[model samples]
Target chain A: MQAKKLKYKEYLEKYKNCPTSDFIEVERDAFRWTGTDVSLEDFIPVNIKRKPPARILDDSDKMCMAYGLSMFDTLNNALKKYFKLYKKQRIHQQEHFKQDKGTKIAMINLTKNDGIADLPNKNNFGHFTFHEYKETNLVGKISDLYSVFKSNGDFNI
Target chain B: METLIFNSERKLKTENFARIGDLSYFEGPLLSLFEDLTNGNFYFFDWVDRDQDYNRWIIYRVLPKHLLNFLNRKISHLDLFRQRPEKSVYFTDIDFENKGYFYYSAYEIESFPKNYFPNEDSYFDPEDCNSIDRIKSIIFNSFARQKSENEYSKVYHIHNLKTKTNYCNQPIGRRSKRTTSVNKLFKAIKFEDLKNSPSFDYYSKEIKLYPDLRNPVQANIKEDENKYS
Candidate 1:
């Protein structure tokens, strides 16, 4: 039998060295308590719970996103449903931002005294600083409903 | 009882999950054949006597598949339906990813006789006609009587998803007098209040005699266990 040499590209192309996959990053506002997104991945609803500070002067305060910390009891139970689906990976995360320019997600915190009117300062890259709110009738808010995901990071529930 | 056909569609927009169950709704040779296979298992009740029942048969199962399809090997739709039965039917798969939802489909066809269907006026029994919650009480009184003296692990779970209440408790084996008495102590309201009411039928023949049991062996009912739930 005559031996014929095979092209190097043919062997290399056929024998692919598989590369490791990357984690599927999930971004949520975490403020609206979007339990369904967490649920879609089999995490329990109780896990994504939120426990706002003793006195949240408005809806924006209770609505800030959570990064798997300080979840309410019921919310945590619901979050476990997702953690179970994703197997052992922690998928809960949020992008730290200062004002209205930040993407709307599941759990978001809005404790700014001036609201959107006080935004546009690019250097507001720290935690929220709430002074006494002089506005009246601006109470807190929370609801249980389906969330709609539009863009890569923007979410509403 | 009637033949509950699978709608064979996936993306069901309905708010409920339709499951396949008992075949006893259909009667005659077809039902008898299935009963022979399962050895008289109650779940095999099928299209033997269509004239017998009507109400429960009218409503059908929700499709787990969006649309049932097949290559037109033959001209007729029914032939294609039976040949490619699985494709003509669908099961819960892929789309559920990211959504924490699960699907339930029963292997048996429903055997609820049309005659067994409840009448608005009479309920199932004549005596308790005035009870306001007769419909509620009747459905709650369902039971999974032991197919055989030795057969365990058989359960009949009935829930009124509409009311969001699961009225029936499981494992309907014969209880000792002592066990019955103990259960009576803690129950806030007695089960008798619901059990004695009409509307619910325990899948029993009003005229037939009981199955012979003293001889220590698995009975005929447990053998042919392919009835709808």
Candidate 2:
């Protein structure tokens, strides 16, 4: 087993200080390293310039003018709601993954073996099958599967 | 636009100004501000005009409500743009300690006449003077309303970024260094240096940028549907 320590502190700082553009780069890197194939659009919407969505509140208070609310208050409220929604979504995803424990454990075990030929059978893995593994490298795929299985515990095989 | 037009009547082309295109891309990133606000952290914003290397520091207080409507529907996530009167429409720049800072209020800036002293305007033109006076009233009344609604509001705590000796709010140091966050905002921008460029830089704090909304996938259906209906 690889003793992989997540760069929580580094990534957290990047998340905090990096603007959406540079943040997307970091995001892409993180996804690549973690075997997350999420489209960049899914995480952050882009503009006409194909630039990532994120803005700096300037001295003009442009945001306040457009929306007719204090930039401070609007951002304050929006952020609270966004985080609340984000937290709720995360929990919902976690709960969903938990419900399919049998499938998850089987997938994790099957993924531990290398190559499509090595995978046991379709009945054991269900929808998260060999096709899903193609997008990620064998090592990253196994690590992702292992993390999920490890965090939630191995289900009855 | 307000930053450049300081008591000037000359026509300023879009080329004269640096634009910070659609700021809606920032809504997601600036969400972090909410956490900072709740934790009692006072915020001060700095605007840097990349072309001229100019900087404006802003410190502001939250606005007082003009009229509290109990029956009004609470704003939904997608319905952020629905306008309402008596809301906090601008940020007033205040001089806390004898320091003069250009405070840009959104409403005041928006109210500025599209043409200050149009060529058509002559001292003999009484109608033009009335139009100008109307513009003044709009700017004045906003300030007047703020003054009248004093007791209902609170002063925002401001942090001075400049040294006490340095009064003029200007760009810091030579060759402006981009902060990590600022750099990220511009990551995907492809710049072409054109002496006579046809496209002027478009500036807005809330325009949804990136992924080019023109693409079919990025088109916001709700906004389009509502507009057509």
Candidate 3:
């Protein structure tokens, strides 16, 4: 398990400096209710316990350990791919699970900068998917990432 | 004027709860269950979809402090069900025949209106009002028509005092009639109006069942029998 984990870390290290473009985090309607105002609380990692509440999607620890912010290259792509999967999941819920009416999808546009690019690697779908290492200061890492985007005014609807 | 002494207190057990997703909005069947339970009132919500052969219901009870903290965002959604103060919320899902699941949860209110003793009168009797058998009975009766006549049928029902809508399946021969009735009902009702209605009363005096988690089966055996029946 240790060797396998290191492999993932080595894979992430390879793309630490890769250049990337703006990506979108498909958000829930609950997060976007405030309209254009950027709530840093929304960006807080699920592992950390403070604040206005972490995103529910982050609860899936299997996806990405640190803070999995699943994103896509563009809003349309996210809608076409991610949201399509989400809608199908909703239908499945209607058939065999509890349907949550509030699971509506929305999007947030974020600019890729030095701070974000340094985090880890991007997937083929244009997501800056990263995992946390043992030595990483998770709270500080997330706060710094949020600051980089907030100060640069890179948050957009 | 009568002084009501709030004397009774009930706390939830630590190991009986389960966490779901966040509570985004403050209103819904789940939230309503929490509020009613917090105020010492009994409440339940149930639904069925014959097409999927699925059915579900939830009964709730809660502590006032926890509810207040939850509403104030003092308790993050992640920690909503975490054990605290030697007690935490309780939740369990008991499955039944025919793809049915009954969910029950509670953290008894800290106190009740002075001189008010909680009993069956606090809410309607569960056996008569909200029970797995009651829901099953509805489904059985609705589908019996199709089984006897050799026709296709579908049934769905969502029972809640707030929504006040009951939809049941009809035989294929009555499909058009059912569709017309459902369409008419949809056109007559406005979702905006339902959203605007006052659904909760924080100071409500009604008291609900204080579940004995240690012996849930003994406390509510009829509902528990769904495991076998």
Per-residue lDDT of candidate 1, residues B170-217 (tens digit): 223422222324223212233344345342234322102123222222
Runs of candidate 2 exceeding 4 Å displacement: A7-9, A13-50, A53-157, B1-229
* Candidate 1 displacement at residue A34 in angstroms: 2.4
In terms of lDDT, model 3 sits at 0.27
What tens-digit string does per-residue lDDT give for candidate 2 at B69-90? Answer: 1102242211221222222222
* lDDT of the candidates, in the order given: 0.22, 0.22, 0.27
Q: 1 or 3, which is superior by TM-score?
A: 3
Q: What's each prediction's TM-score?
A: 0.16, 0.21, 0.22
lDDT of 2 by residue, A1-157 (tens): 6532222223223333322221110110011111133222221111111221112333232222111101111222323322232222223323322331111211122232221211222321111112111233333323222122334554212
Provide all candidates' interface root-mean-square deviations: 28.3, 21.0, 19.5
The per-residue C-alpha lDDT of model 3 at residue B140 equals 38
Top of the candidates by lDDT:
3
Worst 10-residue stretch by lDDT in candidate 2 chain B? B151-160
Candidate 2's docking class is incorrect
Q: After superposition, how far is residue A118 of candidate 3 from its true place, in Å?
A: 16
The better-scoring model by TM-score among 1 and 2 is 2
